[model samples]
Target: MPLASQPAGRRERNKQQKLDRITAAARELFAERGVDEVTTQEIADKADIGAGTLFLYAKTKGELLLLVQNSTYADALAQGKSEAASLADLLDAVMAILRPVVECNRKQIDNGRTYLREIIFGDPEEPHHRDAIGMTVQTEKAIAEVLQRDERVSADDAATLAHIVSAIMFVSMAATINIAKPVDEIVAEIKDQVRVLLPK
Candidate 1:
């Protein structure tokens, strides 16, 4: 019976190893040359896996980008949350939460824009897309928690303002006119909008 369980565990481990390889390959290729220039075949080759196996992990290039970006986004959010926790001012705390996220997105500008598009237009039923959406929700929740620190803000108002802040961040990141803008410029734009949204 233990031997039977051993085989299942091995299979699961193998699956995870393949997934890790796929993620690493995609991350490297996407970083070096934006997702638009990177091919699935190249990623599969880098991962030493077949194209079929690559599809088994992510059905499309967009999905592959999602798989790659989601991890970075999560790390950025975690950093933001930590930084926000220590700030006393509401605007500073909110910017602390948003700055890392904007930096993460703009690391590869085209890829960042593409990732945002995929998050808006990708198939929600897909696991990677779903995870991307979950990241947004988590980001909002983090901001809302920060908002609630103000005695005047109700829980519902905090949540609503957080949603608006998330929209401002995403729109600032995704807008085509801002494509050439520096990360700091984008962060500043978001900060300006978010500052207005916060209670006086």
Candidate 2:
């Protein structure tokens, strides 16, 4: 029988199981050792799968990195969109999304700060590396549409504002939260900044 003719249910189940295992393992490894330090073989070992299985799920470590980044971004934005009203409301929306992610994975985030920093401020040419660039553009465009509806900003200005907000979010993620200056205080500061930026 040809591969296409073979039963798909079992294959699908096995594929899902493998994906679950890999994703779980990657989360654990990322939480424990950070993203840069983890290798595909190590991830496979943690997931109890072969190196080949790792590639089946993610073609490269970069793809897996993108997966993690996108998931985090999507969750933040979804939460933000649901909760925001004004620009300050939007800041609160963003902070709500970020606080938990940062608190839960503070160590991992600190460890991976360099990678996150590079992602935000590094060369624009890096987007040529993957489809994330396009996805990011889409996200910014969506935000721009929202802004255009609420304010008098031009389309280009709206998109640029979205990018600036995105940059601020990145900076917040990179910051260290401590007793001297708590996350709430930082968030309030961000909210104040947004108020200044948004038109009356």
Candidate 3:
């Protein structure tokens, strides 16, 4: 029985190792060249795995991008949440929760836009897409917590405002008209819109 369990444990480790390699390879390639410019074959080669194995992890390039971006997005959200904890001002706390996200999204502009498209239009049933959606939910939850810092804002209104803020952030990042804008400009635009929505 112990031997049987050992084999299972070893298989699980092997799977996780492959996934880590795939994620690292995809991240490096996507950063060097946008998602549109990187090929699946190149990712597999970089990961030291075959194309067939790659598909077993992420069936499409969009899925692969989600797999990579989701990790970074989660990190940014965690960082923002930590920073927001110390900020007493509502606007500053909210921006603390948002600034890192915008920075993460703009790291590679095309890749960022593609990740947003995948989250919005990709099949939610797909594992990577689901993970990406989960990240968005976590982000909204973090923002809502910050909004609630204002004693005048009810929990319900805070939630509604958080959802709206999420939409604004996504749109600002995805809009083609802002493609040439720097990260600071994009973040500033989002801040301006959010400032309007906050209660006086």
Q: Point to the candidate with the largest TM-score.
A: 1
Badly placed stretches (over 4 Å) of model 1 are: 1-8
Provide TM-scores for the models: 0.95, 0.66, 0.95
Model 2 C-alpha lDDT per residue in residues 77-158, reported as the tens digit of each score:
5555555434444445445544443443244554346445545544454432244455456556655656676557888887
Query: Which regions in candidate 3 have their CA more than 4 angstroms from the true location?
Result: 1-8
For the record, the alpha-carbon RMSD of candidate 3 to the native fold, in angstroms, is 2.5
Clashing pairs in 3: none
lDDT of 3: 0.95
- Which residue pairs show backbone clashes in model 1? none
Where does the lowest 10-residue lDDT sum fall in candidate 3? 1-10
Error of 2 at 51 (Å): 1.5
What candidate 2 gets wrong by more than 4 Å, as runs, is 1-9, 59-62, 85-107, 111-135, 175-182
Clashes of each: 0, 0, 0
Across 95-151, the per-residue lDDT of candidate 1 in tens digits comes to: 999999999999999999999999999999999999999999999999999999999
Model 1 residue 50 CA deviation in Å = 0.6
**Which is superior by TM-score, 1 or 2?**
1
Candidate 2 colliding pairs: none
For residue 45, give model 2's deviation from the true position in Å: 1.3
Full-model lDDT for every candidate: 0.95, 0.61, 0.95
